[model samples]
Target: MTAADDSPVHQGRRAALVRQLRARGIANEAVLTALGLVPRHLFFDSGLLPQAYQDKAFPIGAGQTISQPYTVAYQSALLAPQPGDRVLEIGTGSGYQACVLVALGAEVHTIELEPSLSARAGRLLARLGASATLYVGDGSVGLPTVAPFSGILVTAGARRVPPALLRQLAVGGRLVVPVGPADGIQRMLRIERESATAFRQETFADFRFVPLRGAEAVAPAPSQSGAETIRSAES
Candidate 1:
């Protein structure tokens, strides 16, 4: 059905998905609630609706997949956006993540590299009454015109954190992204801007994502480091 068709069946499936997410270690109530409220089925093509609430990723065209529900909730919990937090999302994808961020009461600004995907997501978001500013461009470099975001979420895999994204974060802001070889599993990293020149990094479980494209596809050479602290969940 359409976004407006949030029937009992859809609601029930959505609730079941939420429970599954909780059981899988998504403990943040706010993130769970947001996921519960967002009609994931609406983000899928009518023919793909059957698999919408399966907690699995599905192709969303243009070589990208609507991230599995667990991954979305996991990253949202890591970002921990407060109400009214200004958040930037790279790769808008199905705009499902942006809707989750909106449901969390954040001011959302999302950019996508694929114009068609961005257009489709914008229409869906508008239909659902989610207020998120959508842009079409190279998301790896981020939306600098609206820099200093309170939180940033990247939905793709990269070899290293883009310096531009880091520079766009407001002090205390968090950038949640996946970093690793393009052909291998990636570690989910939550990098928090502690100050003008210092950042704190936390590494989480491994996840495989479509390689981030555009300027981020080419790994950058290692350079002089900045002051940073790292903690790995696997440590």
Candidate 2:
């Protein structure tokens, strides 16, 4: 199926997104600029591009759903990304949020567990001229070597905030993750690293997401004693 023209459609959708964002208490202009600039449809199924602006989630292949537009905007606003900040994003599902983050001129490095989805998103993001370091790995690990980022965002739900990710944050940096107990609902959490050893947690209202699965997820990956999987599976 042919996708809608990227410009006109996205412009209209962006206006609507901005309105929703304000209503939801997203007050950052930089975040709004990024949300308005990125073409959300580029990260969606071609056939559904026409409805890309609606405040709802759409199906992405591999059984994952691109987050609803409001959630993306909300999370970005909560993280309060700055133009020069280096942001590490976990779960690049459709690369929509990554695109939005980087479009505001953030230096973005994203990790995705599903190789197939990651590869496809890498190509599409490049086509949009979004500069992001895309890595196919476990989200639970968060991106190491590139630690001490200015901000971090995770797009999946986890039973508990993985402590490893918290350690990677630069002092005063923020890590936004979905944390909740299994069989219970999830809530958006903004964790600020007060120092190398402490974090301040700010919780938000209810939200739903795919469970976080990777080496550090609630369930340990299959391995013999002292052996590691090295990589996560495709979703």
Clashing pairs in 2: none
Runs of candidate 1 with Cα error greater than 4 angstroms are 1-4, 225-235
Overall lDDT per candidate, in order of appearance: 0.92, 0.81
Model 2 RMSD, rounded to 1 decimal:
7.0
lDDT of 1 at 58: 97
lDDT of 2 at 46: 66
RMSD of 1: 2.2
Q: 1-235 in candidate 1: lDDT tens per residue?
A: 3635898899999999999999999999999999999999999998999999998999999999999999999999999999999999999999999999999999999999999999999999999999999999999899899988999999999888887888899999999999998899999999888888778888899999999997855746446565244444355
**Against the hidden true structure, what lDDT does model 1 obtain?**
0.92
Evaluate model 2: give its lDDT.
Answer: 0.81
What would the per-residue lDDT of candidate 2 be over residues 187-235, giving only the tens digit for each residue? Answer: 9988887765556777787888888888788764334454311121121
TM-score of each: 0.94, 0.87
